[model samples]
Target: MNILYIVGEFPKLSQTFILNQITGLIDAGHHVTVLAKKSESNHKIHEDVSKYHLLDHVIYYDENGRDSKFFKGLTFIKSIFSFGYSQLLHKNHPIHLSWKVLLSSPNLILLYNRLKKEPLLDIDVVHAHFGPNGLLAHRLIQMGLIRGQLFTTFHGYDMLRFIKQKGDDVYTDLFQSKTVLLPISNFWKRKLEGMGANPARTIVHHMGIDVDKFEYHPIKMSQDIKIMSIARFVEKKGLIYGIQAVSKLIKKGYNITYSMIGGGPLEKEFRSMISNEGLEDHIRLLGWKTQEQVIEIMKESHVVLLPSVTSHDGDMEGIPVILMEAMAMGKIVVSTYHSGIPELIEHGVNGFLVEERNVDELVHTLADIFSLEDSISISKQARETVLNQYNIDKLNRRLIDTFERKTH
Candidate 1:
């Protein structure tokens, strides 16, 4: 099958889950094209990205003659006149006349021109990663640019912050169209329904990790506790609470070294917190590492800590793929009972869970995680959970089946 994926950015370090799906589809012998607003330059790109030669399949609007301001101005004028002529003939859909499409004409014009140059015009399926992209895809289809079965996955920010900014009726036209809404978790599924998405059309589809790649290695007891967090330094990640909890443990004289991998907008705030607590030695903020590098760090660590909470701006997580990766590697994980995390972690069963932002509870859980007699058992169960439910191989097959089914 030929598939087109529309995303905000390409080859992003923080969103490896999307990369996993793209590579998995390619491995399954499907043609996959990526349409991204822009490409990102990262210190280390994922190996699968290079192995699959994804860059060759990527399309950006700024490419070709669209890069020149003068050319863009001409294109914009042409789009306005063309749209005006279509309106005079009553040949365009209501969406073509909407303010959203009019204001987005510059991007739409460039994207349409870029897509026209592609070898394939009619795509089998167009799977957009976020809600805003879905809206864009809807508009594109309405303008007769691409033909496909539309599917959109609503991940965190689009459901929370985007909805807050655009109001609940933001997806009204999209929800009315023949678009399937796939929220990454039941948590976000509920949010989609709340925003008036057809319950019948909305399905809870999770972003999964490649369990086989993450070889399971049971954790062993150690004196110097090594904990790692693989997340952006953002408020929703509850990283500040993790820092505070680690600092409290250090004050209690626990032999602990916390290593945080990944960087984001709140890096300065988190660094300030680390410094104010005098935890320079105990905590290390290691910025963005490659997938192989991250796996190596996971091997050295005993536990993975991700204390997630709803940010002030209402940003949340949709079952972090990093948590699944750590669990698949048979490492003990301690995270907060927030969003769809509880669906992945059964407290005191496979992994430990504490209330969001409860530093006392987080500290106590960390203090006991090392000395627990069933640490190995918990680690084993964690791997089992991932292998059974969150395996990418299985999830990808299910995704393909859904994509193949004809949408009403």
Candidate 2:
């Protein structure tokens, strides 16, 4: 099958879940072409990105002149001359598109040109990873610029934060169209339905990790516990709560070393909190690392801490892939009961969970984990959970089956 993947950023280090699916499809003998407005100019990328030669199949479109009205007019005129007026003025190609589409994609002419060129023909499934990209791709398909059965995957921000900012009717047209809606979890499926997505078409499709890459390590008793967190320093991550819990554990005289990976807006704030609590010696902020580096760190660490919470602005998580990755590797994951996390983690069963932003509970959970003489059974269960459900190879086959079923 020929697949077209529409995304905001290409080759992003954090969104390895999407990359896993793309590479999995290619490994299964399906051709995939990635379309993005701009490329991610990162120095480090996941190994599979280069291993699969994914950059060779990537096509970038222009996002240069969407803000200014004068520039928009110039691009519109340029598009007419470059691609001919007949295609632009087609019945499905509305001259007066929604303000959002027109404003965001003023250079649609550039996208049409790139997609129509060689090596991008016969799109069987248009798999868009976010709401905005789906919206844009829906417009292109309507204009007869691309051909496929549109399928949009709603990951966190697109359903929660985006709807809060754009209102409930933001996806009305796309939902009403033949686009099949896929939310990463039941939590998101309900939210999408509440916001007017067709219940019959909306399905829960989780993002998965490459389980084979993360080797399981048995829990070994140690006096000094090594904990780690890999997340952007954002409000929804509730990273500050994790930091406070770590500090309290230190105060109780539990030898701990917490290493935080990734960087974002709240770095300075977290640094200040660490200094105020005198936890600078215990907690270290080790910025962004490549996928290989993260896996190596996970092998050394005993606990994976991710305390997620609903941000003040209505932002939430869509069942973080890091949690699944940790579970797949037989690590004791300590997260929260936020969003779709409970769907993935059953407290005291496969992994542990606490209330969102509860510092005391987090500290208690850590202490309990440390007190346990043997956690090998729970670790085994954690590894089994992901092996059965969150494995990328299995999920990709399921995704392809859905695509075939829908397209036929």
Candidate 3:
């Protein structure tokens, strides 16, 4: 089968789940051509995947046209506004686009023409990554310009955060598609079902992780307890509360070290809080580590933390792939009972769970893990879950099964 994967960013190679899914399809003998918007960051792909072709970018505006204090402030203010009320601020894309496509119009004709040139001929299906992009692909298919079947994966923000308004029946038509509706957790599956999607097409398909990248090592326990989290340093991740918890633990004379990885919008603010709270030594921000580097960090840490929550703007995480990666490495995971997380972490069994954005609970959970005599045994069980369910081998089988069922 030939598949066209439409995404915002492709081949980031930062241990993202989308990359894992792409690689899995290739290994399963499906020819895939990734059509994506290139990122500003200079990232190199894994050598093994260099031969796989990708169309890096398409239509976009020059955001840096005019730089001034007013421009910068306007951009920041716009970001906040767009999130809280996406539908109001957004002009609806046409339900059916015109034959002439342009950046201003975002036409299906232009896209079909561009896609027709791909070397991966005989594309049996067009599988987009998110909802808005799916709307674009859907428009092409609805206009009778594309013969391939249309499909999409609604990652958290695409289905959960996107604002739909009147006259936007794009997803309504898309939901009726025979294409696969793969959600990483039941949370998304239920959300779509409530929105009146085709129940027959929906499947709780998981994004896989390559466990070979993260290996469990026999390391002697350190005197001070350690906690780690690897993600984009954003408001939704709730990294700030973890810092506050470390501060509270230190006041009680507990020895602990908190290591954070990844970089994002909240970098300076997080650093300032760490110093103002006098937690420079305890709270270390290892910004934007590579995939290989993050795997090494997981192996060294005592426990992995993912204190996720819905931000004030409703931006939240789906079941994060990093949590599975941590568990796969035979490390104890300490995360919250946030959206879709419980589906992955069984409280008191695979790892520990607490309420969202609760500092006191984090402190208590940390103390509980430190007090355990057979913590490694608990870690071993956590490892077993990943091997049985979360590893790429198992998840790949699930994905192939879904694809086969959908295509046949």
- TM-score, prediction 1: 0.93
Q: 156-227, model 1: which lDDT tens digit per residue? A: 899889888878888899999989999999988888888789998998888999887898976686889899
lDDT of 2 by residue, 1-408 (tens): 899999977889989999999999999999999988776666788889889999899887754424367866676666656655564455464443443454456646557556545434489999999887888788788766678999999998998777777777878899899999999999999988888889989888899999989999756748989999999999999899999999999999999999999999999999999999988888999999998899999898989999999999989999999999999888999999999999999999988999998899999999999998889988999999999989999999999999999999
lDDT of 2 at 199: 90
Worst 10 residues of 1 by lDDT: 88-97
Every model's TM-score: 0.93, 0.92, 0.83
Better of 1 and 3 by TM-score: 1
Give the number of the best model, judged by lDDT.
2
Residue pairs with backbone atoms closer than 3 Å in model 3 (clashes): none
For each candidate in the order shown, give its overall lDDT on alpha carbons.
0.85, 0.86, 0.70
Model 3 spans > 4 angstroms off? 13-15, 44-113, 116-121, 144-146, 164-170, 218-221
- Name the TM-score of candidate 2: 0.92
Report the poorest 10 consecutive residues by lDDT, candidate 3: 56-65
lDDT of 3 by residue, 104-187 (tens): 222232344444344334667777777776776666565443446666777677765574322334468677766667777789
Among all candidates shown, the one with the greatest TM-score: 1
